[model samples]
Target: MSTPGEKPDTRELVEADVVPRSRWRMQLVWLVPIVALLVGGWLATKAVLERGEKITISFKTGEGLEAGKTKLKFKDVDIGVVEAVTLSTDRKHVVAKAEVVRDVANLLVDNTRFWVVRPRISGGTVSGLGTLLSGSYIDVDVGNAVKPRTDFVGLEVPPVFASDIPGREFTLKSAGLGSLDVGSPVFFRRLQVGQIASYQLDPDGKGVTLKVFVNAPYDRFVKGDTRFWHASGVDMAFDTNGLRVETQSIVSIIIGGVAFESPADSIEQVAAAANAQFELYATRADAMKQHDRIVDKYVVNFIDSVRGLTVGAPVDFRGVVIGEVTQIYTRFDPEHRRFSIPVEIQIYPERFTSRYQTGRAGGRISDDPKGIANYLVENGFRFQLRSGNPLTGQLYLAMDYFPDAPKAKIDWSRSPPELPAVPRTLQSLQDSVTRLLTKLNNIPFEAIGNDARTTLRTTNSMLSKLDADVIPRAHDTLASAQTALDSANSALQPESSLQQTTEETLRELARTSAALRTLADYLSQHPEALVRGKSGGQP
Candidate 1:
């Protein structure tokens, strides 16, 4: 600096001659930091935007869901986050805006179901408490395979995986539907395999129809011959023993379910229509269908025929239960203009096949002609009334095979086969007692009382006459004979006639006593004389 300013050295003029050239270097140093800040801001913005995909999901309710703080998980891994929440136009549901990771977008599919996962009230499956720390969001169950993007259906409760896929349009008409709730499991062979999808009243409002969905493997087991029944809660029962209902677990008190059992042999044919309807019956309709052709079209009256029967009551052939009474109801028969009770029953004809003899040795009646002749000649089928609960006088049907009985003349038109009458069990015994009392009541009590009185009077009179007349005379006669015997005994006394003989006998006895005493004295004095006298002479 001093050399360049040599011209100014003469005056040492203010040394502020020229600003340093290093000013530009100092400005460059500050500019580098500003450029770096700008690049960093742009990078951060791009990273945030690239992390996820935008998605909108709608829900009926969002009680357990939260926006901004909620996360969406797939296979337990965080895949997305809830960005915003707003109500729909109708204010019926909450619309949730979510940002899912781009990689997981393909997981959304038509079959994918969305529902709120939270703790259950009763002792069942519970979840979503982890959301308290992480947050609450829809759990995405991306199936094992990749799926197409679509709107997923939402469920009020967690959707269960069924073994069989249920038809969307299929419906089940049941007696009681309001009693059942969603998520109630349907059982096949006592194993849970499906659930109730929804329920509603029929268009006529007479009954309810339940929409049920069965899952994969289980649906395969449901064939055309499968039977369904209400397998939930307490089924009402009223009988001679009074009202009785059976209940299982306490949990069943609040929830109900349905069950099905497949027939051992079923038709392999599938329904022609995509959606097929099946009608369930409490009893076998085969026999009834056959009977319908023969019987006149009279209204069926359940009260007249089977009102007395209860659950588990047997519908039998010859004292054996070929079936059982299942349900009973009263309905109007429009043709007859009268009310009638319809009884529903379930029959297992196969149960009676073995009981009927099928061989030449005396087989039961068979539908086959070749077997029919032998059956007619050898055996016959009949139904008999049997007591199930003796104390309650509950009766059931029993079937029996009789080979020795005559063949019954059956009327194909309007004729029910006569049932065999069974001997009294405890229930019949009570009935017998009742009948006996009724018979006794028919007797004329006044006439019986008069006859009894007359008979008693005659007996008393006969006894009195015997005591007063014949008995007294016989006693008098016996007294007279006894007096005569006493007199005869007194006259035959021995003392009067034998007195002299007695005196002579006493004298002899005294002399003999004296001689014996004298002999005893002599022997004591002369023992040697007593011994020699035995050979010599008589003393």
Candidate 2:
């Protein structure tokens, strides 16, 4: 249909179209560099935000940590990832290089704590149970300080969860370290509410010092007079009451625990502040024993034998326990060459203070230290040792009205006022015997023997007369009576009732005489007993 350049053919001819290979190259070619730059810049920005900060952490051992796999967590939330794990150049420790997100990187402060979290059964608690399936992870504890840090040292054992809890801490002094560990549970009425934070030997080496933490609401239960004791493991004991086994829980039986209770007298109490000091008793009994606060101490020097007296013996006031014996020892006086038993007693004056009413124009103690002792002295107060159990020979000190007690005064110069002591009951008996012997030694025995010999002579003379005269007459009468009975018997039949009766009467007479002789012999051997009944020395 196309025509040549002739004018006539112009109407029927058409020129061929000129089309480029592509036109898209022109518009998109410029856009290629711009889009690429924009995309590359976006990727760079993502890398900067997500790439994280690389920091090394020193561990006792690499343990469950791995490169690019172990993740760091805070409060169970993922916060960082481990990039690499390797042993230090010296091989003294393992160092892990971890990448922490920028958001949490500032949390890496001097006070921050980190440790590997794994399946652990500690302090009566089972933790990290999820690690059983998903494997172990690094646990982090953040600090309030925002000062930036990179390098860190990890805790071999995870820090106690109680450290992160909102509560108060206290110090417990114990006789010695028992089954308690760093993470031992602290119990309130056998309920798990806190934990033992740490423990160490006391500086004076007298006991162990323990640091404990109690969680928020439970911490309020800690009053100024709270008492703490080791409630760890199984307490198995056999006493007069029989077998007793106590445990806070099954977990406490295995891993140990600590427990606290309000003081015996907590009528007026206040919440104890953090770092308050308390005594951690060894057992429940000891803890209860500590319920009484020591208010007074006294030393009683007794001249009597302290055989049954021992430490921990009860000290009573009118049969009511007011104190306990703390010590009993004897010291020899070099100058006098005499030994005296010094017994120490701790008195709880609070007992009397609680009994009296306040602000009623009532009796009040004097400022003078010897005021009470002086008043008691006027009231016939004296200390005496009495038998608590005669069978066990256990003796306890008793303080009561002893009006007849020898007048004495307490020596107040000593720390424990020294109240004058009297001899024990048994000692008093021995003293009485010694005094009797001393008086008997002064008697004129020779003159008394002469008088006794004279009396014996007179008694012998009377007996001789009775034997010489009364015996002949009595014998002749008996012969006469026997002759008469024989004559009567001959008159009667051989088996007659009169002959049988005569024989029976003779036998009875013989028995009576024998009994009379035995009685006379007994009287002669125990002349004083006839008047004094019987002596204790007699069988």
Candidate 3:
């Protein structure tokens, strides 16, 4: 404070600088806050940049899916996000671009599945509320180790969560439509245990092939003799009464399923070297094949047999449906040099086999030649044509087996009884009708016309006789009898004096005849009738 000049403060300033002043201050007030802000900003960017393994998923439709907002989740935890959406080359599928966190990469196996988790309410479960928040996404599931960068198939529902069981892949060739599709369920003992992986047709177009995957444990129970059948869609039928059809939930319809039954004695494992081909039979097809055996197939060569045939007509073996007419067709047989009809029939052999097994060793029930001969000797087999539908004029084949009658040998040298060669199915009914018309043309028209004329002439002559001669004669005879009765009644009337006199004379004659017997002895000869006739009876 001594002087305001600089020269005066130099010593004081120097002394103050050398010693310095102990002052209280806030520690890093601005710098601390700035450093905190930098650290927080850096952490936020790191969190946003965190990424996952990328994968591509495909779907049939992308109606509700979104790219940026859609999140890939596993067990309710967000594992990845959809990065982009694009159409496949075929334009039939939606390809979803997804990125999964690196930590989950080891879980991505070949068996991993991706399916859209949409809002679903079924039997008793509801899921997919997150989908409503950010749209649909390709949900992934980690499976066993497999090839890297594998394809992720978008499922319609969660892959049936199951462990790998002992199973085999079989290819089935079928003419009709398959009962299963990709993702269809495979049932064991009526329980859902497996699913169909894929389906396609062979290159030659001969049949369809299906790939099936079965879960373990249950797979051990399936044997080589296991039978599989379609368990989809309700079979529907309608009759004159009302509608008859099966109904099921919408989910079961879209996903075709299968059911299997294992045979009692079948082994657990199938033959490993057996061909990959497996045979599956529909209910109707199985029944049809069973009918093909045992029954004798015959073709009718005459029109009479065909005109009376119809669908559901009895194809009987002794009045039984041993077989049925399945098909009939008319075509020219190039080898035969003539146009002919072919008939196909299906027979059930079980009927005969059952009976054959029940008989003694030497009995007539066996299929052996000797047994057949013995059976024929004991029971005669014959066929008789009978009317099936009287209104439709349809005919059926009936069989008669008579155990009481003696068997007759079939005469192979001579032509058998003529029958029409026609199919018993609906399609062949038309051809049968045509054959009937042709047979009618062979009748003699002139003979029929002459017989009709003769019948008419005889009827007219009889009518004329009854109207003229016979009727008049009966009327005249009745008139004469009436006149005679009237004359007799007139003479007997009491009002006339001659009637009273005749009555009195009849009474006197009765008394005179009683006394005449005694007087006749004295008179010797009393000729009363002769005297009366000569008018001398007055005495």
Each prediction's Cα RMSD?
15.1, 17.0, 13.2
Score every model by TM-score: 0.52, 0.69, 0.48
Candidate 3 per-residue lDDT over residues 343-449, each given as its tens digit: 44444545554542644343324546434533543455544455655555656666555454434553333232222222334534667777888888888889999
In the range 1-539, model 1's lDDT, one tens digit per residue, is 56664564556555556766764466657888898999998899888767776767788877766777777776678788778888989999887788888777776655655666665532133456776665456777555345565444456666544223343223566666634666666666667777776666778887777666776556766665456666566666544335567443444445766666655444554432323444433222211221111111111123233424566565656555456656556778789798755544554534434633443322322346334423433456544345556456576655466555555543224322212323224445777899999999999999999999999999999999989998999899899999999876765566644565777899999999999998888778767776665334545
Q: What's the C-alpha lDDT at position 425 in model 1?
A: 44
Compared with the true structure, the alpha-carbon lDDT of candidate 2 equals: 0.82
Candidate achieving the largest TM-score? 2
- Most accurate candidate by lDDT: 2
Of the candidates numbered 1 and 2, which has the greater lDDT value?
A: 2
User: What local lDDT score does residue 326 receive in model 1, on the 0 to 100 scale?
Assistant: 61
